[model samples]
Target: MTQSCVARVTAAYRRIAEADRPEVWITLRPEADVLAEATALDARLAAGEPLPLAGVLVAVKDNIDVAGLPTTAACPAFAYTPEADAPAVRRLLDAGAVVLGKTNLDQFATGLVGTRSPYGPVRNALRPEKISGGSSSGSAVAVALGIADIALGTDTAGSGRVPAALNGIVGIKPTLGLVPTTGVVPAARSYDAVTVFARTLTEAQRAVGVMTGPDDGDPRSRAWPDDVRLAAPSRPRIAVPREEDLAPLSDGGRAAFAAAVKQVEAAGATTAVVDVSPLLLAARLLYDGALVAERYAAVGEFIAGDPSAADPTVAGIILGAAGLPAHALAADQERLDRYRAMARRALSGYDALLLPTTTGHPDIAEVLADPVAVNSRLGTYTNFVNLLDMAAVAVPAGEADGSPFGVSVVTRAFEDQPALDIAALLTGEQAPEPLPGCGVDLAVFGAHLSGQPLNHQLTDSGARYAGEVTTTAAYRLTALGTTPPKPGLVRVGPGGGAPIGGERWTLSPAALGHFIAALPAPMSLGRVELAEGRWVLGFQCDPDSAAGGTDITEHGGWRAYLEAAGEAATG
Candidate 1:
């Protein structure tokens, strides 16, 4: 049954109450006000009104104004109650999305580390000890925790994508000027973009679609081209950083990235190594050079009003920006233009560039010890993106060392679709299922899971990971005698089998046809009932094939079996 907006939102509020992650929000709307908004939307739906985002709840970064909510931007003394919603938030509200309230962020959106917020650092959604990449920390965490369906964050130097990566959610850094920023508190006016965080690229795009177009209130807003086309090239050419550029990554991060690259290649794209030194140099300019002066220019007066009112680190950075002379700022601008041109040329031959979203994940303690240095490392791959005027989406590649690992799909400005397309492939998230859309859910028990060998086949077919599940206790799992050892899930009569673990993925109708047709013998697509009480097309082994395989059902899953094999070999 399709759930109503109120039901979904009520559940979300309940979840938020249970989470008790106070740092994720700066100002939460009264529960009554939130329900009231949802009730209004429900009434509108009853009246036969069409609402694209009916009942959707969204969290806005405190830097972005929402009517009646104080815009703190993580600095209490700088708070103000904006009488109106930001242009971006207003549009979402008009589409039937409700305001959940204001989320915390790095003070003035100044630092990449979430710890810069006076309200307290926004902890990683999945790992309490890790830093939630920021200044959009709280907004991203809110979405990652299901507290909101969508969250608005500003990206000056990867504020949006960095946090999304750390929390295992989707971050869409739209083409600059495509989404108006008039109501948003600017970090670097010219480079600032209102970004979106969601669980899937499809949902993010839906929000972006409603928010796109020029707004008189925002001079920075630009009209999208009439002929703008969203697409995914069947044979995309992907660009990767040279090996030396990957030195900053931890071993797990490197392996996760390598796995992502292989998935794209298996999906039919070819990869090329590119020297991104120039791009890295441009990134350094964002914080290390005179470019930071823009942040000073945006909020310097407020800092001067009362230095103590600002976060010490944020104040320090802005104060330093005050020292950059006009000539140095000019020099940095000139260098930026040169880097943009070079990047344009470097990316011209490829459909998109794939980059590790961050060098490493650091815990709050580590960031607090040496704030600037650690924050700089996090932006090593992201800071150059906006300066180069590109569109990028960060999607979770998989888990690395128990934390989420993500990669960004980047392309020239306005080429946002290709990035989304690649993200969907890598992350296994299908495009938003508009009415009458054609797609199918395909469940897999082994090999096709993220980071697993042969997982690339699903990606190549443009499949998306929908969720995980265990079959009804009517299946037996066994290790096939294949050279690489694959799992075969065979159905047995009720009570004659044990529940087996697996992942469920979605694929477009066209991709599904191709995927099923290419399956080898002993493995075929058939129905499997999930513990959730829904049946989906999933991997089923031929009964005869199970005869020659060793029963390993006690391990519970393919991954578990593999872990046992490795342990036995090492032990």
Candidate 2:
């Protein structure tokens, strides 16, 4: 029997515990409570209720109000029991998503590094020693670790995007006011946005759709034009900053970004080099200019009465904001307005702008040593996003030396759908795999893993696929370099070519047919034997299609081949 979504989420939650929870959460709802929510959702689905999320498990950052949970914003003294769920949280629950619990965050939502929270720093899911980027730290970690399918985080200055980059998940900061922030504790009221974190773009986009719309409760909310609704663009013109503008990125980050740009171009998009200094200047205003005062304005009385209540870093930052002169604040506001206008004009001709989600990932110790400076650096690409009233989605570009690299797609406010659509193009959807007894195991040699070109063919077919898993030795992989890029697989004799590349995925017979029918020319589905003697759907190229292609078998896999090529070019 197929495992239910509730069952999958329960197993995921338990598995997280088995791996040693990362202290990403401040409070977890009792398992019983969660189960109750899940059971109710399953019943609703059985009754044919139109549920958008339908059994999706979601985590809320502690800063956002959830009716039964205390909103701590990672500071105990600042904690308050909200009378009701935040508007965003209410929307998610209404969509059939069950709240897992409240996750930790930067104290008062001040730091980009998750370490500032009194609850303890959130470690990177991929590398325990590294910091989980924040103030959406716990949310990102939770999603990355599969503790939840979707998470709600607030982004003021890169809080949502940075953590997602570090944790290798999708982080979306929708246009300001797109998701109401009425019950969220404000970091910078005008710039604060409820962000989404998910393992895949589909889930993230779905979550956003549920939470969006004009909310009378939030004064900033505005109705989006139906015709201009945010979705993936048919043909995208993406602007990229010149290399000189990205001087702060590490060697690995720069290379990964370049590769990502190439991938986007390969996916049929035109990329233009543009100056982003105006936006960067505006980002500076958030901390260095009058915006700091907004922080002071957000929680002044609470901090003034109990300085000990806030994290030292958060308290210090907020205190510094208090020193800003009123005139300077006015001047900074003027500067922000001017920059916003400049950004609108600059982005008028493009479908979206692409930038590295963060310059580089900093270690936990580095953040502790120079909390403010290091955190500011991580926000280079993200800080200006909300300030400019834009929508952004950060998709994993690829891994660089074991660490993940991500790029953000930005569009004018209310163009969230287009931004998400572009992101889907950049990072194709990888279907969720069925449980062991639910369906047959299949090995995919190409174009179905997250970020691959043709993965959407699998997701749209309702195939349940898991994250990437290496194949057993025995398959021969070839780079056919067909249109839109494709990989071919062929079985060889015993002890033939080593398992060059493959990912274990699954699909129902019906879904498999749908996936096959959607394939473009030059690519077809075939059964290929795995080393383990199992056979499943795999990409096969026409014999003539490999005529002019370079043999890359020695590199073992396309990813390895590309890595080698990049090293050679850079070296």
Candidate 3:
């Protein structure tokens, strides 16, 4: 609004014209109408109206209806001009975002590779020769190329996530049914979700936030649970897929994923390599098992009526499900339920699961020559999400060789905020905000910091890393001569100690009780005042316990003291 909303729209249109990527959009909104809307937006701003999205330009994947625009979903023969916008689109528009147009995608959102669309392939924004991951291909490319601030897409498999990874942007696929899909053409009905794309995690999150709410018209839309944890763990126990699970990863992908693992650890996360075969096994069910019949249920009639009008690859995949026996689908559902339980047990105490978004990025020719295999391989790390009823946020971690590489932070359903926060933490693009009220937050200046000797006690107790914080300048740190060596924290009455750095973690009440019951003499739990003027449960040593201990306050925190001690020992 500051630069004139109309001017922003005009500039975006100019960029789109210069880019000349027709396949990216099946129906570009008339420039005059967009400018008029922007002008109205500017007047609203001038009238002192508050707008959260405020002039944000958006592109909608064609499968999601936009009033006055044809919902082709990249197949012209099935096009329909809707009189009203999809709920997701209307939400963004209501929040002051202006729609650029309806973008192309894999016909009926059936394929991962962008090439399945009859509108023509939506080329990768980075290297035109590379395939833009889809079926949300054009929407992702639009954001990556700076043509739009945000884009709406649909994800049944990896449509939302894969395209964002390939194009180097952020994609947030919320908990299924969290964002209404009422006006969106069904991909797989039960599994499909509306996703938002943006250049940064915050923007994508902001867009998704505005779009989240109940949709009475869409039975899939569910209310976010009132008891869900609001903060991403400041120090989380992350589950990493075993190396074998990544066997299809190219050398460059492996190297990049390794670096991504290190980045998360640096952000205060502790990771354990675990077998994720159950999740992988479940992923195969999407296309390789009876569950794919959902796609058949979605549009089998349209494809059956005129297979010639659909992308043969999409038509073939969806049609294959048409003949699946009803009992077969029922049996697979039972199997999927078992996998879900197994996945939960495997991820029992972890805050999130981190994985490469895809095995690798392929060139357009490679995908064109072998569409199915390439598409399947790309989904190796992505397909099980919706099936498992989880939420995820995909962000760029760095690059693999010369190709852009990214990772997804996957968390249980309704934990969208944490998934997004973890993705933000990895990229160092945004800081996570604390959302208390669900679990007990404990501030630990010593033993329980990630990687510290006694940290396992907290992890074993199901503690989640809340974040790093410092005590108000009224606490002292002391080195206690205990077995395994622990730090003692003591509060000096007033103005007598330094502000001591520490890390915070959240644990269940029962876990906290057990954690305290096992604490040996000299160590105690009490309220500790933070620099932010808030008090949280924390470790505080009895003043007598520190009477004979060596003062380590100058070292700041336990980790720093340990590092200094290690350096001294090495020297």
Candidate 4:
């Protein structure tokens, strides 16, 4: 894998040079410099370094700083060179990913349509005549064009997700502040989130995992919450919009969403219709109400200094918010709190909420003819997300009106894994693992596996199934004579052991403690080694307590052992 970084970087530069899509990039690094970095990464990997993103080529949206590259945010006069990388970029680099260049975006990230850029509109990757959603327009197109393995974008008003939806790629808009936005030009500082775009949901989720953490530079950065679910429930309760709420969808778009809903059901999820009025009302507040004042607060003075330096529509929107009364801002806060509460109640028991990433895919000419109305409509399903402090994963569903149609799976703040899990299910891609260090990963080998009687103990404690695994040959499995038959995994000092099959489960920190505390004697949590990677918290037995237990190692797993004894499925 390390040997391939040079070839991958070479291919990316060639693709960039050959695409003839000048508008997609604002400042590309010299091919030689990028190649040299890739070469260094190859060397590091060969030297026994662990690089999760080794050879992964990344594109940074122009609004986010990439050391040595100018961050234009598609506004030439506002461009500046940063001495260091943004927290997001730094993390990716540390994980062995190399930056390709700075991709274009709407001027100051103010519009949903990609046309607001002074660098020239970023045309859709699939069909040039259509609008590429913004303000992270070029980054999405870059990823779609295969010029980058992972692209970074910012989503304030669906800029990140909308573009990905248009380009038929995976877009990850994490829960607010999950990836610190320090060194990024803020559209709405409090609402802005650095998002990831990749061709596959698995790749997109991996990139997101690399960027998840807290940063001192960003005051809004948050430590991963201990209560968030690391994975979705097996039979998830998915929330869908009321039929009337989808009135904004055109015929093709509506049909595509219906098909997408079918995909969700096929994934073993049960859907429930819910009223989204309060959320929609709050979404309007992003721009139509006092929340727009944050835009003015971000760069209103800069636009004021040289109005001609910014895009007319972007300038107009920012300027309009400049004179709002302070009271309106205060009142809007109270109103938003109420709407959040209502929206929360509406989504109480759901694991994920689904919505079209946008109402429809519009043509560039059509949006150019009527920019504001079309842009607002594009944000119909998206503008409420950040305001309500939620996470959403947007992925291609199918096609609508000859353009790719996509849906956003929304989850409560920090519950991003469930959103990605459902997206993976819809796309038939590999489901993501638990976020590293975010939750406790426990390995179970007995009656607690899926489809077994005692599995509810983990589920009841809010644990989620991470994935299946096989323990190393160093461990042995024994039949523990408990009320509900269980398997005791023991680490034998040497050669007389066999591989054991088990499942890994993720639990919140609080839940793990409670779960372990409730475990019966001889079933304590201990370090159990897997076939690969490091040891994890797993079920183990006191060797002394297992002296009289029947050895079940020859059966390969507890389930297999029980099957031979005609007892595994009895529970």
Candidate 5:
């Protein structure tokens, strides 16, 4: 039998308790209460209410308010319970997601190395000896460990993306103000973005989509522009930094990034190497220049009030902001504006920019030996993102010497879809197609499903999305042993079959022939029955393909299968 939401929550609790990574959480909800919330969600689903994130559990960064939970920012002296939920948390709750608890962070969201908290350094999810990357460390680890379906992290200076990259997960650092930061404790307020971390880009996208738009109390919050319609371009022009700019990368990191770049180029996108020295210089300003004053502006008073309670390194960095001359802040701001203009002109010709997420992955002991230096190194690729007001998605590119390697796809503010489109290409998933128009309705399964690896094949072939529909409980999905990991759908007898997830695309008659002619063995077009009793031409795999493949019928879809596989590896 399928697990109920309550059962999943209960099991997750047991796994978390056994995992015993105490440093990852500053405050956790009572197990009974969390299970009860899941039960309530299950009840709502049974009543036929529409909940996009029904029964999903999430972790809140300690810096954000969760109504009754303490917003500590991982600083014991700063802990406080809020009377109201953060606007972002409320949005997720309203979408049928439940909060598991508050995860730890760097003290007052001050550092990127994840070890500034009194709660103890956050250990990497896969490599315990390595730094988790912070100030959003715990939030990323919670999602990576499969303890949360989604987690919220604030990105002031790569806090969100860096952690996700280190932990091998998807981080959606939405455009500034797109997701309200009203209830968040500010860390350079102008640059702080409420980011979502999840195992897959689609999950992060869904959660983030719900949290976007204006929040009354947040002066920085704004609605997405009318012109920036959500969509993925069929073909994209991606920018890569010049070779010399990437010299800081470790050999393994460089090789992993090169492979990812090759994959993107093979997928039909054009890449151009451009000098980003000005952007790199701007990144230095985040810590080395007057921008550090913003940190002082946000938390200096707290450090001054109780100096002994602060982490030595975090306190030093914050306190150092005190003597910064006002003229320096103004000068750096002026300098940053120029850099932004330079970056805009540099990226104007491309849809998005692709870069290695981090230059290095340091171990916890190494970070402890030289906290500031190692932390600074971790932000080489991330620090410039929020300052430039761009949207970025960090996806796990591959592993490097037993550690996760990540690549970030960035685009100008509000043009998030193109970055995501390229991310799907890098990960071998299909980019979701735009809304449908006149054409023949054709059902699709496996990698061809919208937003899966091969969805671009349809969109590139001039197919338009018709709708998403599910199949009857007479089909099974299998994971074929293919190079890019495609799935095969097979019809089964009623007693053993299960409902399968799929999408419908509208393709012209002429396009359908070309699509089929290019399809490899074991996959062919055939009639498929929808759950609603309607029939449509769709993908089907030969029996021989399923003979040697793993039966993934339990996942109901390829996306779910991949997510499950990722979670299994984490355990």
Candidate 6:
């Protein structure tokens, strides 16, 4: 009642309804439910409780199961009461997040255009006549409208990212197995992933960290590597698709993408134009190849059982799936595997691949006129990600014609941290204030570490450099072989060690991705204990990669070593 964040947001929701209500949500939480959750969150905060997502209200795409809610997946006949929350939903709840209600999506998660839903197309939050990209339509609009801090969505193709791009929000689709897909209605199980949408990368990442991790029940869930730490490279190498590959982009989208590249370069990165045809081809296979059958497999029986209950558009798509022959499916699977290998090989040389989130933004009417064709076009860049086992984070670059423009940072699986880091850089969303009462401290070194060549990398990754800090005198510094000149400080022992240098930068997991991707070879990230007995993410040298590097521990820090080298040369 004292105007809590949740209350203010709820009130705003009502006001928007009174003004010019767009069909953003298919179903909303009852007033009683909203008030109860808000009261509980307020009490928890007042009691000084440890809540990771204190006062954060999140919306769930209707396709995802929320306990005590009906999951229609845009098809009312398919609606069912989920007695238990999905794995991802349960995690958010455990983190003290309040669920507002379920939002509209493309029926059965079959289309990228939000209009396919029987409940009514979700109009773009910025412009009501425009389509809100889907199948994560309502989730994106909810976040963009400030009705929720973050929203849960499913991205098989561009469901998660497309909506975010159209609505001007951050959409993060982690590695294929990074976030479990349990409890969400599957569109294409193998390609399906639970995604996060939020107004800020910081908020989005906070939700991701709380939701991610291997679940025993989910066969696809895998353990995260222990060595993986969210730290940026001294100089990141990002690959941009060649102009020819982006031919499908409208003039405005192309210009926005170019501007985003400039931003990445301005942040002290090297951008190399590369051909992305192979990736594009793989994306095409999602609908063209046997993968369509997978979509049918998920709900083919349900649709057949109750034809009247399904959305017409959804029925047509799934019906097409039924006709896919076994031989064709087999051939398609083989081709997909081949393409996946090629993608891995092509992406190995770059930290991450950057591309526009969508080639074009169609209005709701345009999408409705030709749903399948327009929806397929939207997924041109996104469909291949999960198939290739890649992680991606979509960040707002700028606006095009009053609509939002966004770029996706893609990397090989497990490199999710770096991709998010790079996205933060492009979006210029670094240094966000921490949630109230959260004591997590971040230490940055290198470009994002503070006062270094690529320092913007840190700020862009949403990291606030706490200050300079020294290692516990147990570290050795080496100038690893890198293009922009990088130093790796390794903790060797507890005694007889030098005061190895670095900065203390605190950031959420999403910010950490941008930082990690900027890391140059020979140097990698690791956990280093600070002199104050605090453990923070820091850099380490791949011992093998540092074999012939210079010992710069005598200089105490990377900056000092570089300065001394420059002076020696001048002399």
Give the poorly placed runs of model 3, Cα more than 4 Å off: 432-571
C-alpha TM-score for every candidate: 0.76, 0.74, 0.79, 0.92, 0.77, 0.80
- Best-to-worst order by lDDT is 4, 3, 1, 5, 6, 2
Q: Which segments of model 5 are wrong by more than 4 Å?
A: 432-571
- List of clashing residue pairs for candidate 3: 234-465, 234-466, 235-465
Per-residue lDDT over 1-571 for candidate 4, one digit per residue giving the tens place of the 0 to 100 score: 5357899999988898888899998998899999999899889888999999999999999999988889888889988999999999999999999998999888899999999987899999999999899999999999999899899999998988999899999899998988999999999998999999999988888898889899999999998876666677777889999889999998999999999999989879999999987888899999999989999999999999999999999999999999999999999989999999999999998888999999888899999899999999999999999999999999999999899999999988888877888888788987877654667789999989998899987876557776799988888888877888888888996566998999998889887877777878888888988888678999899898887799989999988887888864565
Best-to-worst TM-score order: 4, 6, 3, 5, 1, 2
Instruction: Give me the overall lDDT of model 3.
Output: 0.88
- What are the per-residue Cα lDDT tens digits for candidate 1 across 249-273? 9889999999999998987788999
Q: What clash pairs does model 4 have?
A: none
TM-score leader: 4
Candidates 1 and 4 compared: the better one by TM-score is 4
TM-score of 5: 0.77
Clashing residue pairs in candidate 5 (N, C-alpha, C atoms within 3 angstroms):
428-453, 429-452, 429-453, 430-452, 430-453
Of candidate 5, the 10-residue stretch with the lowest lDDT total is 431-440
| Most lDDT-accurate candidate | 4
lDDT of each: 0.86, 0.79, 0.88, 0.89, 0.85, 0.79
Off by over 4 Å in 6: 1-22, 431-467, 470-571
Positional deviation of residue 75's Cα in model 6 after best superposition, in angstroms: 1.1
User: For model 5, what is the C-alpha lDDT against the true structure?
Assistant: 0.85
lDDT per residue as tens, model 5, 1-571: 1567798789879879878898888888999998888888889889988887877789999999999898988888888999999999999999888898999999888888899999999999999999899999999999999899899999988888999888999998888998999899988988999999999877888888788888889998977553353444466788998889899997888899999889889998889998888788889999999989988899899888889988999889999999999999999999999999999988887878899888788999999999988888888888999999998989999987678999999888876766777788977766644212224678887888777778887766545576788999999888998867788888886656899988988765667777778988788889999999999999999877787899999998888899999999998
* Model 4 bad stretches (over 4 Å): 460-501, 521-523, 527-536, 540-557, 564-571
